[model samples]
Target: MNAILLILIMIAMGAIIGGATNSLAIKMLFRPYQAVYIKNWRVPFTPGLIPKRRKDMAEQMGRMVVDHLLTPEGMQEKFNERGFQKQVIQILQREAKGWMHSKRSVADLLKQYAGVTDARGKMTAYSEEWIDKKLQMFIYHNQEKSIDEMLPPEWKISAESYFDSFAARIADKGARYFESDAGRVQLETLLEKFLQGKGSVFNFLSSMFGNDKILDKLQPELVRFFRDPSSAMFFKGFIIKEWEKLLDQPVWKAGAQLNTKSVARYSVKALNRELTVLDRLDMPIAEWAPSYEEHIINKWIPELWDQVQPALSAKLLSVFDYLELEDVIRERVDTFSVGRLEAMVLAISGKEFKMITYLGALLGGFIGAFQGLFALFFS
Candidate 1:
């Protein structure tokens, strides 16, 4: 009876020690959330394994996530998948369909999306500003350049070719003006003035010949002079000289007379009138572009996806590099409280951990049993 009681006592003690040690070991994995210090010395294993190695664990986690889970190849593969593409397309189509039936005007849409209150006014202002800026830039760039240098070679050639015709037209017009009754009257007055300017003898001759006869002769002579080729050549030379003077002047000199603000405003107005689409800004988009949905679904979405998916896949590596995803994961893990980390780990592998604890207990019990048997054998 004493031997049997001894054996029973040994077995019970072994089981209790085994179970308690195992439970304590399991608890030690996460107990005492912070390090414990006694006077000048620090207690060993006070903050637990996880808390002590949190930084290294976080780093490892980050590297593991980046290297294995969120690899560029894996992302590219997912992006290229037909399922992802189809989902994106379907989402875009649904949004487009909603927009197509919307009663909101373009201006309203602009207001909602871009915070633009007056779309037309804003566009006009922007256009005017753009025009003004461009004009200013042009003036700044060409202010020192002479018109001759600024003019295109082809334009210079064309202008030179037309000079003769221009001069001929001017001469023809001058002759016709002189042939009119008004021209005759002006000729008579000029002759009288000339006689008066001369001495009384010339005046008496002019009166004796009669002003009418003098004018008739003067008019024919004037017409003949204008018809003469030399007259046309003279006008052409005059025109060429004037043109050369103009061409020699710088662009700033030419533009000095212009009102740029007024020009920009007028240009904007003309553009607004010519672009009839601007008028549709106040009208509902559905009214103007009813086929938008069909086009978006059939053409735009597919084309956009086709272009964007490959680009995204190609850029996935660059994006991942820029994001430093591993560092992000590591930082997140580091920030997590020990208790929270423990809870999460337990949640994932709680059953396995329990089994490990039980295994440890079983092993401990086996060891205790062997020790007990050895003591008995020695006795």
Candidate 2:
């Protein structure tokens, strides 16, 4: 009975020792968050394993996140997901709808970023200054590209057409005038004045040669020529031919002849007229802005997003570099305290560690039983 009791005591001691050892090992992983020092010497297993290697672990985690977990490829795949894109578009549409309906003035929306306010600390009406500045920059950049280069040749109205139209109108008016008796009399008087304006010698020659009679007779012929449709057509064709000759000259030479300052002044005046009409609105901006915004949302956004999808990989790489992704990951990991780290580990594998401790105790009990049997047999 005593021997049996001794064996039980040994088994219990072994089991307790094994369980305590396993528990201590588990505790060692997280205890003593800082290094323990004894004067000039350092204590064994002073700092916990996790605390000792915290920096290395953080760096490894950062690399893992950048390389294997949050890689460019993985991010691009997420961006390409149709469901994800649809969700994003839906969110944008909602926000845009809210913004469009909001009572906030255009200035109110922009004042946060631009800070263009009045003396009362209230947002002022939208200013054309920024628009003017941007437009000037655009014009400066495009100065080298002539207007003709921007417009296709087919879009230009032919010079012949304008000339033909002008000539036809003039000929029609002249025909109407010559068809009247007043026009015939005016022509006779003009010819008479011309003949009399010459010296008396010329008038004597005109009388001797019947030039005065010839001039009186020529009036009806002149009237017929002006009224005739064939003559009218000829004059129109002549004007168009002259216009074509002008058009055939180099465009640059024609442009050089024009006063660019006058052109710019007139263009700006016309644009300002239209813009002023828009500014003094009969209807609310909200009514018209939706149509424009809807156009952008429905047509432009899809096209823009399509373009962005193809370039996402390169853009993601650039963004990651700009964001300092590795350092960000490292910094976030380093911010975790030792207690937080222990909690995170325990959350992951607490049950497994508990099982390890129990297994240690079971193994120790079996070994002690065997030792008891050996002692009983050898004795």
Candidate 3:
């Protein structure tokens, strides 16, 4: 009778105390996250020791993550890690081959990959249209920081180079138009009109391209021509020369408006297109040299930067929010993360949380053993 009674009591005590301890320990981790302020004297370990310390912990974790698991440089180091990306590409190639060998046009696969609705549907958003909200945000939010940090920052490198590049581009453009028949004609018209009237020549070309006035007979050919890098480079050079001459004009020296407003507006439009081009290529902007980047950022990025910052920050935060491991673990306590799963039997960090069962059994066994021993020896 004593043995039976003692066994039941031991089991009850162990069940209650063990559960209490585990709960208390875990609770302590998150409880005191915010510091307590009383009489301007702070309490020791004011709140969640585990999570309250998490700011520093998070910073360290951030650094560690940047260093080991997901650092930009580290990721690049493992670019072909386990050949996963390569294997994916190879699988795609094989699948493509299989599809080719079969009856389907790869167009069907491309449509699926491209998120086309179906064979009957056209793309709602192509490379040019898709926002890549992440990259957009990065470019938008970091515009000022990007300029301050990326530009040479020297008076010559930063300010002078900026204007000089602008002038150089404009002058280079002037050379093209002033020299080329198409460009010379525009300039000749402009000079003649300035000598007498206002934009008597460009007035026609401008009016013709206006949406309601002229159906863009040139739209298809223009889109195709603009897609060529060499063509763009040549025209860009031509425009730059003309721009340089405008900046150097004696009328401006006498304090005429340098017409900076127009230049800035034009730059923003050009950069918007350049960013679209880079997106289509799926190229990283960081790959460009500083000087080359100066041309892009300095010349083209100002107008859209302010509009895009908030959008970018929100998108970046969204991606990070999705990657939060703690939330995932708590939400699905039985599950482990992809990292933990990949490490699998190596860490024995499987989903079973065998520890729950193991701990319960071990503690129960000890409690039972103590009760049995006490009943045998003392009771």
The true-versus-predicted C-alpha distance at residue 209 of model 1, in Å, is 32
Q: lDDT by residue for model 1 over 297-332, one digit each (tens)?
A: 789889998998898899999999999898899999
Q: Write one digit per residue (lDDT tens) for candidate 2, span 318-350.
A: 888888788898998888999999999999999
> In model 1, what is the error at residue 116, expressed in angstroms?
4.4
lDDT of 3: 0.48
In candidate 1, position 363 carries an lDDT of 72
lDDT of 2 at 259: 57
Residues 1-379, candidate 3: write the lDDT tens digits.
8777777777767766665655555445456556687989887766666445544554555555544665344443444354654554455555433433344333354555875444322322232233344334545565444233433436424443454355445445554544456744554455445445346555666555543233233333433444445554666566566655543444324223434444444554465566643232223223333335444444334334434434554465355557764444344422333333234433553334445444655586577668777767864
Residue 213 shift from truth in candidate 2, angstroms: 30
The models' CA-based lDDT, in order, is 0.86, 0.71, 0.48
Candidate 3 at residue 151, lDDT? 33
Q: What global local distance difference test value does model 1 have? A: 0.86
Candidate 3 ranges beyond 4 A from true positions: 35-45, 71-74, 77-365
RMSD of candidate 2 to the true fold? Answer: 8.8
